[model samples]
Target chain A: MAQLLPSVWRHIPERYSLLGSHCENCGKDYFPQRPICPTCRRKGKIVQKLMPREGKIFSHTLVHAAPAGFELEAPYHLAIVELKNGVHLLSQIVDSDSEAIQINSPVKMVFRKISEDGKQGAIAYGYKFKVVRNAAAASKPGKPVGKQSTSSKK
Target chain B: MNRSGIVGYGTSVPRMRIKVGEIAKVWGKDGERVSSGLGIIEKSVPALDEDSATLAVEAARVAVEAGKINPQKIGAVFVGSESKPYAVKPTATVVAQAVGASVHMTAADLEFACKAGTAAIQACMGMVASGMIEYGLAIGSDTAQGKPGDALEYSAGGGAAAYVIGKPAESIAVIEDTYSFTTDTPDFWRRQHEEFPEHGGRFTAEPAYFKHVVSATRGLLEKTGMKIGDFDFVVFHQPNGKFPGRAAKILGVPDEKIKQGLITPILGNTYSASSMVGLASVLDVAKAGERILMTSYGSGAGSDSFWFTVTDKIEEEGRRQPESVFEMLKDKVNVDYATYAKHRRKIKSL
Candidate 1:
């Protein structure tokens, strides 16, 4: 089963892991495993492991003009996710409208497709964050509109 | 006169190989068609993880290994490629970090289509000549992607070459004279952040390759007070083997002198890196006091010609490096077309 798809298997662990690299020499953490330790200039001591999947959006931008490979996926939000480990990751914000995304908004990582060159294999299932919607707006005194689940009994 | 030359050199190519028959099968074309029409039998492709930056790092490592130059002493690193990984970011910074160049050195990217590699070398020469820095590294590398089944795909491949330029006396090859011919014409162009390049094929064949190369070569010869007969060798930007040969015949450079050490037959059209890689191969065979006339052209319409005479100092430095260019070519492993697609990540339906 695994022999048929080798690259797919390599990416399975990346699906859920908020991956980051820890510098063995300086004890510094980087969102992506750096080839060298920036603090120490030491080589070969940086090790890779999982990072926190939940964080707040530090900053974001809506890209209107993407590269040739990402043209069709335009108008998507790209955000800098600040994880608990002090490592910042640049990722796409998905499953939520761009209007709701604000600085410092709490978000959780979810798997989503970035884009495919169509000729190259699609970059499958990478990390993205979503802002949890507020519940108070759905329920009001005059209208119990949040009761969609309750009405399901009919 | 400061000696600025290649102290070391390195190269990296994808392990996977793609053959002509495989491409012919997929595209419903004949294997002979790709090999004969495009002048490429096989091309080295980069894996999904490999980009221009990574390939430059691979080449820079080889350059460093061939010399006694200190990493911290390197005052600048320049990467020239049309296929940079990011639009806003500087690829030189990533490549510098990858090869462990000094953090304080100036790092930047240069673009001039295929002529960019030689352009970077000219820039390095300027900096070294001015005494702004002690040593600088100029790299020309690319992971050029041609559209599937397009005529370009057959000749586009992934590779890189790095040269360390410094004082000429201490260098391998000293820059003698440089001549440039520039015009505003779009023979071929790729817009910002574009994956595929657009071209006016027949126009480029005439005006871009033949017209510019002859003019630039003649310009350098006249300026340097030397003629075609004085040079032991000539190197030109090679989009394909046939084009350079045709240009050579037009310039009266002779088939034997022009064909020696030409790399497109194996490495494919590396865009900006093509001519410089060929130059590096020529340097391997060039002797002290032997004159070399090199002409470089970019697709947007620009060419630079330089005259150089090898020094005895470089001949000694050559021995400290890897086995000759021929050995490296023998060490390579060839692959088929499907693997090429996978390496370049060109097949993605699921």
Candidate 2:
């Protein structure tokens, strides 16, 4: 708990809202935020920037061998998503089919639980990307009301 | 930022679900019987990473984004949940920070069973109406739990809803009036360290949910001089598909009034977010100038009744989002019982 809490606290902006840094000079974006731009050095004008919530899949892989903490979530899809500004971040793909995941597929960010320290430890939350099934009208409104599956009355 | 109305609204339902039959099979019971008895098909299952806090954050983020309201003006944040991730810490703070709300705001977590969400709404109304803040974010969410074979396992589900309350002129719906009725009827409760709650079975009906809900609703009608037919829509705490209808019957609200808001059959009982999500559902398709009546019940027990008048801003550009209640309901992924247990942490490996 002690080791995990401090790190999560320090990276709240990045983890919660995807706050990163963008260099105006070299026109590059960074995750985990960089104080000094490597390309332009001191001459670069770097400012805090919020990465876009929508991106495209640059590359992906199927991880059947789960890590120590993520044993329950074996055989998951891990991908590197390319943001709008060309910044790429490695993350897990969730709520999508293995066949549906392809390079350059449009995806959107969603908040989700990342990991927990252990039994009775702090729960960490961050963004995960999902393949976009439908960008417009995920479901239509003003449909006549109907029973989903079960009857209300006995 | 006019007095006390809903400026922004959003809802979140986890994509994963476990059918009642899957759960019933594990317990060696008739799946069809249990499904019919509870009036539920399946319930939303939180992914391994989702909990009360994550759900709240997602819903609140959508509320802020959909309404196009600047988070800097939000003055208070109140999260209502019985399934908070941290017992000693406040989930409201996590939500406030996630949405980039200003630091100079009051925040806390509240609990009172399913109606806790409405309680938070009432608190925000008072604060905004009294000039304590410019705007307040109220959230209701839960990752409800149940014992392996308990009846609650059939109906308990996970979801969240968030509302941004501010002046009526800037709101999508103006909250006309509100009322509450409370009594020490202990029909259902969970002790300090208990994981799942216990209920009084049939006693949960007439004397608890009906008594408080009916009383508060009737009291509101009497106080506001409004009758059942004056409301175009009615929403009640949906612990199950049958309970809301039974309560509405006692209140003289027609079945059509409950039709638009009764989503429990598909999503199950979202606990604190139950009635609040119904309000969001009604707001999704309600015409401007339409009237809505809502009542929420928490089983310790008490009920809160509210009246709303949808404003023209509801249909205005940029105020509404694509993530409607109906859409969240449609976006679902089916999972088996073993996967459900693993995702919900019921099969802990630590």
Candidate 3:
């Protein structure tokens, strides 16, 4: 429980807000906020950036036997999502049907409970990706879709 | 009345639901009787991992996105809930961090039974109206508790609603007036170590819920000099599907005016989120120039009432989110009583 606190604190900026870093020289973005761009090494000018929340699944797998503390969520889908900025994020896919996930499936970031230490320990929360079925209508160029009106109204 | 109002609003309800029939079957009660008595068909049950904070973050994310403002500009965040995951920590700070609000901000958790959410709204209204902050967020969320075979087990639900309050010029709905009525009425309460709340049953209705709600509504109307007919819609705190309707009738509001917000039949009473979620549902379809009156009652007990006028910006802002309360309601997976127990962690097998 003591060790979990610092780990949760260290990842807050990246986990909560998708804070990443971009290399000024190579025009490439790195998630998890790398302090130095591997490609540029000494010359890299890294600046903090917030990646777009919308992305597409680059790959995925079914986790039938989840690790310790994740037994309740067995058979959940885990995916590597590539945001529009070309940065890949390894995240658990939630609020979705496992059978429906496919390569290139559009996804969106959502805040969800990642895990809990115990019955009384601190519950860790962060970002998870969820499959967005209506990619076409949702990914329209200028307008935001699901964010606007409630279902009955539209 | 100051120039402060709701910039954006959003609601989140868990996908899992347990039917009243399912609950009644386990207790050997008449499912039909239980359903009719509570005016609830089903109630949302949070996943074993989900709680008030997660629900608040989800709702607040949608609200912040819909508002289309820099999250860094939000100066305050308040979360109202009786089921906060941590008894010691502030749920508001977690919500603020999740929503990407700036580090320099004021935040706190509030509790006032079901009306706690509206209390948060009142605080945000005051801050925005006073120009103390550029944007303030008020959220009501809960994973309400109900002991096994208890009457509350039929209606206690899980959900959340978040509102972004700011200057009227940047708002989708403009605040006309707000009022609160309170008294030392302990119609319901949960002690520090108690898992489920205790209620006065029949006593909760007349003196606690109805009295405060009616008083707050009438007080707002009188203070604002607005007639019942002047408002296009009305929303009342829903402990059951019947309470809001009964309160509306007593206040002379037409059934149609309250119908859109009367979602308790399907969502159950989400405790702190009940009336705020109803108001969000109403705002989803309300048109420009439409006036809405909302009054919320919390056990222990008190009420807060607000008058709002929908602005033209609502047409655009309302379309920003892909999901709505109605969609969340329609999209659900039903669980039987045993599964409900497993999800709610009622069956301890240690």
TM-score of 1: 0.68
Scored by CA lDDT, what does every candidate get? 0.70, 0.87, 0.87
TM-score, each model?
0.68, 0.96, 0.94
Count: clashes, candidate 2: 3
Better of 2 and 3 by DockQ: 2
Which tens-of-lDDT digit does each residue in B3-122 have in candidate 1? 355555545444334655566777888888768776666766665545677667656756765656776778888999988766667778756654556678898899988888778878
Q: Poorest 10 consecutive residues of model 2 chain B by lDDT?
A: B341-350
| C-alpha lDDT (0 to 100) for residue B120 of candidate 2 | 94
Which pairs of residues have clashing backbones in candidate 2?
Answer: A113-B49, B2-B167, B2-B168
Give the lDDT of residue A85 in candidate 2. 74
Per-residue lDDT tens digits for candidate 3, residues A1-154, read: 6587999888888888899999999999999899999999999999999899999999999999899878877778899999999899899998776666899988988888888878778878888988884655442222211222222311
lDDT of 2 by residue, B1-350 (tens): 22599999888888888898889999999999989888889999998878999889989988887767889999999999999999998999999989999899999999999999999999999999999998899999999988778888888999999999998888999999999999999998888998788999999999999999999999989998988778888899999888898888888877887887887888889999999888888887787888889999999999999999989998887676466687777778889988888777776462
User: What are the root-mean-square deviations of the candidates from the true structure over C-alphas?
Assistant: 20.3, 3.6, 4.1
Best by lDDT: 2
Q: What is the lDDT of residue A30 in candidate 3?
A: 94
In model 3, what is the error at residue B112, expressed in angstroms? 0.4
